[model samples]
Target: MVMLDADPAGYVYRVLDGPLPEPSRGGLIRLVGVFEKVLPAISDEYASKYYTQARDLAALATEIEAMRDE
Candidate 1:
């Protein structure tokens, strides 16, 4: 789950506890990339949300990397 600010400006929380379906990973990565690209241009409110989302994406990526390490 992902939560934005009260005004839907920035990202606040992201939770990834379960397995992600194969088909969704690509799209998810794409979305994360888009967010990373646009984050700097947005308002502080939006940037905040983007920051959290980006953090979540980074965490997810790290998890995947660790899986490959195994």
Candidate 2:
């Protein structure tokens, strides 16, 4: 890893030796996508249940991508 930027205000940004590996479509992101497709099949009584899990996973994937050096 290496420091890519810094400031007197104590802010800094870092990056690894190279770009972060791309997330596979058949990976976490894909899993979330699959879950979304499942939602429509679920009855309303259970729609929220599946939706929450899918939403949380999607948020997690976003957070992880944000942290990686793009």
Candidate 3:
């Protein structure tokens, strides 16, 4: 089962406690790379709001990588 909860601050994506399927894993890898590549430009333009978003993305990427390893 997958559940998504969203609010003004951010979102939470909950899924079964196991490795993600290949497609999802691949998508996350790409997502992380894109965010990393764009974050500097985002910071330069958007500043604080984008910094918070970047921090959140980094945290999510770390969690996804740990799940992939498991």
User: What TM-score would each prediction reach against the true structure?
Assistant: 0.44, 0.43, 0.48
Q: Judged by TM-score, which candidate is best?
A: 3
Residue 31 lDDT in model 3?
53
TM-score: model 2 vs. ground truth: 0.43
TM-score, predicted candidate 1 vs. hidden true structure:
0.44
Q: Judged by lDDT relative to the true structure, which candidate is superior, 2 or 3?
A: 3
Better of 1 and 3 by TM-score: 3
| Candidate 1 lDDT tens digits, 1-70 | 2432221222112224444455545545555665566566667895667566665655465466347548
What's the true lDDT of residue 29 in model 3?
A: 56
lDDT of 3 by residue, 35-57 (tens): 55655665455464655465575
How are the candidates ranked when ordered by TM-score, highest leading?
3, 1, 2
Error of 3 at 3 (Å): 19
Model 1 alpha-carbon drift over 4 Å, by segment: 1-17, 45-69
The C-alpha stretches of model 3 lying farther than 4 A from their native spots are 1-19, 43-48, 51-65
lDDT of 2 at 10: 16
